[model samples]
Target: MVEFTDWDIFRNLALAARWTVLLSIIAFIGGGVVAGILLLLRMTKNVLLVGLVRVYTEVFQGTPLLMQLFLAFFGLSLLGIDIGAWTAASLAMTLFTSAYLCEIWRGCIDSLPKGQWEASRTLGLNYFQTMRYVIVPQSVRVATAPTMGFSVQVVKNTALASIIGFVELTKAGTMLNNATFEPFKVFSLVALFYFAICYPLTRYSKYLERKLNVAG
Candidate 1:
């Protein structure tokens, strides 16, 4: 049996933590682009498009992330796409993250006073101009805190990527546990690494919320 010292466990988990960070970046950026598009679509006064956005958001938010990852990993392979765990995990998380993000942004946009839009319209501002100049600026102020809060959730959800054989922090911990038979030691660091990543985000998000509220 191979022996794992405390340092060894720490060192290994730390190495794996890098992948976790990288994946989180990928998901956040990719999800942002997608959510932006979806938000714009929802804003449009089209019944069919609005319904479609609603359905997309509900389907993703209603389902478990694990199942999404599984489908992305296995389902793609079935179609002979030959995607790896990394690609699959990223795809699933991006979609999942985008759904929530769209909701957050839409809620932010909607939170603006109806008068703001009406005023913009009276000023002869078109839809895009109204959003760009008036509505969006105010909405962003409201959305900042919530978006930061949601980013923490995205980071935590990266742990789910492990189930699909991605070598992120959780997967690394599991592998180390099996090899060393040290579940407590292994998973403790796993949790700590996650906490290390998430705690600051949590604190900062709260800070932003307070700061934004005060300014507004």
Candidate 2:
């Protein structure tokens, strides 16, 4: 068995933590772009487009992410498409994030006063123009807190990536524990590392929520 000191284990966990942060950013950014497009489609009067977005969101949100990752990694490989674990994990996360974000922003859009929509129409703005110049700007302010809150969820979800043999923080912790025979010590550090990354995000989300008070 390879023996590892506390410092050595912590160092390795920290290094892997960087990958967790990187993947979270990737998933959130990619998801946001995709979700934005979906939201636009939903706002339009296209029945088919709205139904498709609804179904896409339902599929992702209805299922557990762990299963999604498994399908992306192992199931895809079974189809003779050899994708790397990192690629699979990232893509799965992006899709998952997009679904949730689209739903969240849809709610934000709905929260807008009916008068605002009517006023935009009276002002001769097309649907896309209204959303682009007016609705989205205001909805985005309302969406910010919840979106940031969801980002914390995205970061936490990165731990699941370890199951696919991704050497993110959780995987690194598991490896270190196995080598050192120190599950408690190692896992405690793992929890701490996750907190270090997520706590600030949680707090900031809360702050944004209070500041916007869009509900009121």
Candidate 3:
């Protein structure tokens, strides 16, 4: 049996954590782009576009992320498109993050006063123009804190990507544990690493929430 030292485990876990961070950033940014488009659709009065966006949000948000990953990884394989774990993980996380972000931004848009929309229209602004210039600018204050908070979720959720053989932090920890037969120490350290990464963002989100309230 091989005995893994703390340094060895830490080294491997830290290495894999970079991929975790990378994937989270990819997912968050990609999701933000998609969510922004969806937000626009929801704000518009087009019934067909609105219904399609609503269904997209519901389908992504309604399902378990694990199932999404599995379907992306395995289901695609059945269709003769040999997908890698990285692509599947990114695709699933992007979709998952997009749904929640759309909802978050939608809430922010809805929280805007009715008079703002009327006032924008009175100034000869169409829906897109109003959103671009008036509504979104004001809603930034409401959206910032929640968006930051959701980023913490994005980081944590990257762990699920490990299930599909992506060699991220959690997957690295499992491999190290398998070699050392030390699940408790390995997982505890893994948890601590996640905490170290996520705690500051969580705290900053809270701080922004308080600051936004004071500013308002």
Query: Across residues 1-216, which tens digit of lDDT does each residue of candidate 2 receive?
Result: 566888899899999999999999999999999999998888778899999999999999999999999999999999999999899999999999999999999998888899888999999998878888988899999889999999999999999999999889999999888898889999999999999999999999999989888777
TM-score of predicted structure 3? 0.96
Error of 1 at 64 (Å): 0.7
Structural similarity to truth (TM-score) of each candidate: 0.96, 0.96, 0.96
Q: Which stretches of candidate 1 lie over 4 Å from their true place?
A: 214-216
lDDT of 1 by residue, 79-142 (tens): 9999999999899999999999999999888777799989988999998899889988888889
Q: Model 3: how far is 141 from its true place, Å?
A: 1.4
Q: After superposition, how far is residue 135 of candidate 1 from its true place, in Å?
A: 0.9
Against the true structure, candidate 2 has what lDDT?
Answer: 0.93
RMSD of 1: 1.2
Worst 10 residues of 3 by lDDT: 207-216
Q: lDDT per residue, candidate 3, 1-216, as tens digits?
A: 767789989988899989989999999999999999898888778999999999999999899999999999999999999999999999999999999999998888788889998999899998779878998888888999999999999999999999999999999998988899889999999998899889999999999999898246
- Whole-model lDDT values for every prediction: 0.91, 0.93, 0.93
